[model samples]
Target chain A: MFDIHLDFDLLEKCNRCGACYDICPSCLNIDGYDPRAVIKDILNGNAGRWLTSVHIYQCLECHHCLEICYQNYGFENAMTAMRLRAARQGIHPPQVRRGWDMFVKTSRLGEPSLAARKKLGLPEPRESGKEEFLKLLEVYRMRRHGPSPCLRER
Target chain B: MKEFAVFWGCTIQARFPFLEKSVRVVLKGMNLPFRDMDGFTCCPEKSLVNNIDHGLWLLTAARNISLVDKEAVDLVSPCTGCVSNLATAKGEILSNPRKEGEINSLLKEVGREFKGTSRLYHLVPFFHDEVGIQKIKQSIKRDFSGMRFAVHYGCHMMRPSHSLKNDDPLEPKKFDNLIRALGGESVEYSTKLMCCGQGLDRVDQHDRALQMARVKLRELKNTGVDAMALCCPSCFLQFDNNQHLMEKEGERFNVPVLYLTDLMGLAMGYTPQALGLDGHRVDTEPFLKKWKEISSRPSAAAAFSEGMKKEGSFI
Candidate 1:
């Protein structure tokens, strides 16, 4: 599940322009998936119901829409808000849901195997936390939104 | 026993260890020094797929790069995603002093700072640029003169060139040049500039990914190339994995997917299994067998680079 960031001005800019629908690689390629519908939903003041689309999780955030939009609407921002809204409502897909768990616990999406790194001719992993810097970001994220759901379980 | 750092992202280690094996064999043949840090984390390219906060992605990326030593000059990655992610952060943070200060401040808290401005190179370009194509061309004991290949450049290495910045974005064919140097024919096609749909991995959208890959493979296959050379493991997986998905959906393409290093190793006479040709989603065994005969007997028509050079120089 994901929510698009919809400020009043940006919302007003949608203008029901079909360019986003026409240009979206995801929408065009899949069945029953339309970003314009999400925009329409947002414009209609139904943010909560928009999270039900499995289509929301498919956006690559390439900013193709943002780059082409006539109203200068930030589609990627809206997409991000949709994703966060979905995360808040527990709508994440299983793979992403599992990955979110792993990321928060280890602060790693997934660890490449040690043997694999050796074979790839890559450097061994090293410690790199600016311990204080990480703490501050965590605190900031926490204060802004009390304990991220991704990190909460971990 | 080389002296470079190992910058493994998720794909090579988890999904395609054969790519790692090929890289080792090729680097060993080239005699380049390298190392892998013991505990590096994800480069945050996946999270970015979700279009997660850029600041978080940057910090996570910086934190990962900061783990590398101050002395290492280049971080070689088998996965283009990792290379692109690091290149994006490094370019962004280093190019903007204000961003650098903010990143450095976060880094300092973890007792780390990215003082090292080492450029990140996807392994293919590093070999083509630093190792010298002429040098590699001379080392071709097993020439692939009669074999043809499609060079899959993968997007992150080129696009949004503003952040990661392609040294030669407009003309990204160092892989073709290096491929030709190995006695292999680099097949050019109309869709060479399109992506392999690897950029969709983070969002878990299989159909979108499949469709994106379909367009590129469809065009590459039409060119009648023997195999496709990959610089990134993610692209490799997407292109390779989607071949099966397409087949399940009744679209069949029997092209062999290969890492640039795998081709290099094959040219150096490494065993097919040693190079992990069998592990590919699209079986490369047929191409590997064909390559053996092609390499042993150079064709007079192996004029890929010569033809390109005659028209205009390829970057």
Candidate 2:
């Protein structure tokens, strides 16, 4: 099972601090992109409202806020938590779906282009770890689903 | 100087093999102790992998680091995202024995373990710190003395300083120092430290991504920078690839995007074709032509003195 938690203590301070707002690329440039408003809703237990909003995906994960935060927590934590929740409910952006599927299946978002390598006169790519990764994912999914019959046999 | 593996990550290998070529050319020129190791996967690209599954993100990155640990070699990557993700995972697992144990238990079935001993570095810092500017200066066949560059320190290179600790997270100077070492002027601009906002593209926010690229590109263009030099492949995708798309639509901001290695390769006397500079969507010919013209011409100050002497002007 997946458990997600945010530190309200650091976030409480975050709610009062607007320091990173001026620095976060999204907050500064994107219209109506305010993490403080999202934090207020999160602290008030209304984070579900943002599950459908496109704003959560706009954080950029640049860690600008983390550098500026006095507690080093930053609004990125809240944004990441909201994203994880939305993803769990299958409410994520379509690209996230495609990317996750590729990662789960191939263990990489894209494979090295054999044709491109040949054209570039580069050597063949080394073997990927996809098989082992898929095995690990199976074990992980089994653990998450709790005691599958076929898993116990192995 | 310890032997290390190059974590090229998915982007460069998959989409931008030319970037990989440039990095390899420069590293070989410098004779760095870098090797290609098998069994590595994605850095899992934090924004995508971490957002969906934090445990999986941490576990996958730990697994990648475990390979470096197994080889008893440090890891160096040209991709900022890869180094940051692996380092964050290494930091987390090393701090939390219980989590380390859990991940290692899963890894055990695959004959891998997370020892967390190997060091991780992005190429810029590796060159800045390990390679030494003095050596870099001596190695280059030419320098960017008169050329002005706008340096984009991709955010992951030195942010969440608690995890990376590579440079000053807020106002990093290492990239600038490297630029100056190559004899280029690291032009200071208002949005010098701003994020490239490449993440917006991954989440299917194309317009916003363009908006973000527009902000910094406009500033660099207005400041009359010769090129925007950076390290990350994603940022390259945003500025070079996306800027090309914008230009095709008749909105021109002709700022050529240069990988840190591309510049290094050029300075080492590698041809533009050999370094794959031609592969870029945004033409670098203007930047190249201008540099060639300026480097060949006599200095204006010297020219002024020569003219005064010729005219027999004396006070």
Candidate 3:
């Protein structure tokens, strides 16, 4: 039931516009990183190679390209769509899997550290929305349920 | 100063409770009507949650936001990811009636509704726009007159400008404005707008994450700034914790990291211990030491201004 759609119209425009190339943090700092090249591959339907590549993960989702993009369609949208495809195919890095499991289970990446909070003299943390969130997730999954193979575990 | 709920999110309270303390001290010191509310989850950390399940990410963020909507209170957060995620979801839901109805109906199963009315703000913008810089200046007890700071406006704080619209995104000035209002020099550098690249750590590319953090840290090391100031826990983690890791590997990028609130708490005369700054991975002692040395000395410019006032002379 889950699906991601890439806009070739925007992608074509992004391919033509190399303006974001100079502005994307990854394109500038990370060597051999180019989203325009990825966009070209995407247009050519050769994007399967990117799902397993580290370059997909390097986009940083910083939205630098979005802010600087002529079409407001930065490399991040394409990168995010690819990552989602990779994740649905269960191609997540172990840390992402661990993080996803925690989010699904706890409704948060973590609970407040009791010992640390006590030592710091901070107030007891407000109650987490764990139960309600799980219920909400249940409702969400019921409606939008798909073969979410990434976090396949309950 | 409308009452607001502080969405501390997962990171600050869990991995860095001290950052929570710093935020609390500033909130209390400034007498803002911020409260700790119940039943808030992760902002679902857009990169991780959204990548896996876009609907789940939006739903989770909508649920957390609906809590604030239930109370008819505004929402504010210190964490960039939390604010960004919430605002993005709010923007998405508000702009799409179908999505809003769908999410709200789902939320109804859990006894909440998304009115999509509560204003969401990151702390930097909240202080810059809502709290007013004049109030900030008036509250300062010991300003950082001679101190130099590299302000890292974490990306999510202002980007995706369509959603957040918090600043110029490309060339933000609020954090720098806040720093200068507190009497510190906001150091300008070429890599100033560079993302902290903390997202790499979440994907199991710890080495590349370090490589990303190193890019900025290595540059700031020689910029001669006392500390790198930022607002997000993720960026804080990347620069402070990761920098400490690199230091262990003999990379001496001795730049201290400070939260915007941490600097504010200090400038407002809160002690480092009271502000919970000692909990940071990199020691803020050197920055504190230099600040002490710098603020203790009478300001030459202040003296000149005072003498000019006394002389009542105009050239």
Candidate 4:
């Protein structure tokens, strides 16, 4: 029940140039998958076809394609928007759910700690006893739950 | 004095004071003028993904943007998230005429109005593009001739919106050029192109993160690089913090992680502490020790005196 709108104008910005496919870290790193094909299918209005391809999950959302594109097309955002649309219908991969679970826990969209800091004998925030560390986690938990109750009290 | 507004987002003032220190020194040494925008809250990016209906993100970003909008100078950022958020705002206001209206409507709730015209610059693109690579090269008092480094360009700095420019994300290596200009060798490695598993680390998918780090480290290790240089703090967190866990789990790569600013600070003869290298969660000491010993030698400056050396080439 999210208020989702499809921006076809932004959608059509893709030239079907296959530039995204050519430089995709996911497609290049993996096998038997292509991102451009998904775009072609979507542009052809055959959105059903993308469900069969594993390429959707392969994207790192790294915005690599948006870099070289002449149109400055928000390829990554478009893909994400499409995925969000599809996710509503439960037509997404299991990895997406798992990824969601992880994001919810960390509140951070990246790694929780730096290994060098640990190895270099540097201290982490928790070790340093900085209150912000706990506050950050608590705030994230509360926000993730949508204002039910303060997570700190729980 | 070069006047600029200091955009200290949630991360630097709260978590990483080292970046702030290095930035202060670099600017002070160059005689740049900057004032911290106090009373600014979180850019509210944390709330955006959480689906908060509060107009906080837009409000705070606009409030800060408006504060600097008055100064009419380029907004400087140390946090990649802040840079990306502000740049995204600037781009949205410029490109999507309707978005400008929507953001303005939201901002009005907080007693602020965005005029849809402000320029925000992340430190990396600022250092590389505006600071002039040659200036960084010329400012160096120490040479990093034999060191091979993998450059980590964080996701927020990449395009879809402009502000951070001059490097292709898939083929991202301008940071490598900056490292080279400062007398270090920039190496192309696997994780050089991957997300630092940032969002996943929050979700308890430590194994998934380890796999991501392992693959990238394995690639860089095989390349025999001395360290990894990064432009984004999130990427710095992933590579520098995860390498130990990745190794404990049987993935062995002992690459040191260096911030491009920290590396540039070091090249300018700033001490290890001054560059905030010691504040890193990673054990940069071994690399710092090695670099210190290497640079301290009277013959060390002679290595890059012949000019900038390319990746895999030694003086």
DockQ of 4: 0.12
- Taking the candidates one at a time, how many backbone clashes does each contain? 38, 0, 0, 20
lDDT of each: 0.68, 0.90, 0.89, 0.60
User: TM-scores across all candidates?
Assistant: 0.77, 0.96, 0.94, 0.70
Q: Which residue segments of model 3 deviate by more than 4 Å?
A: A1-3, A146-154, B301-315
lDDT of 3 by residue, B81-184 (tens): 88998998888888888878888788888888888789999999999999999999999999998889999999999988899988998989999999999999
User: Order of all candidates by lDDT, from best down to worst?
Assistant: 2, 3, 1, 4
State the TM-score for model 1: 0.77
- List model 3 lDDT by residue over A1-154, tens digit each: 2355789999898888889888777787788998877788899999988899988888898888888887878878899999998998999888888899999999899989999999999888889989988877776776776535544675
Residue B85's lDDT in candidate 1:
76
Identify the CAPRI category of the predicted complex in candidate 1. acceptable
Deviation of model 1 at A66, angstroms? 8.0
- On TM-score, who's better, 3 or 4? 3
Interface RMSD of 1: 5.3
Model 4 chain B: worst 10 consecutive residues (lDDT sum):
B46-55
DockQ of 2: 0.72
**Residue B260 of model 1: what lDDT?**
84
Q: What's the C-alpha lDDT at position A149 in model 1?
A: 84
The best candidate in terms of lDDT: 2
Q: List the residue pairs that clash in candidate 2.
A: none
Q: B1-315, model 4: which lDDT tens digit per residue?
A: 246776655455445657656677776665556665533444535213312222233434555576667666667786777777766656545566775676565555444567745557777767777778777777888878767778777777655346555356456556667777888877765456666655445434455556666667778878887788876666666777778666566666778887777877787888887667667766787777778777676464565653446444655
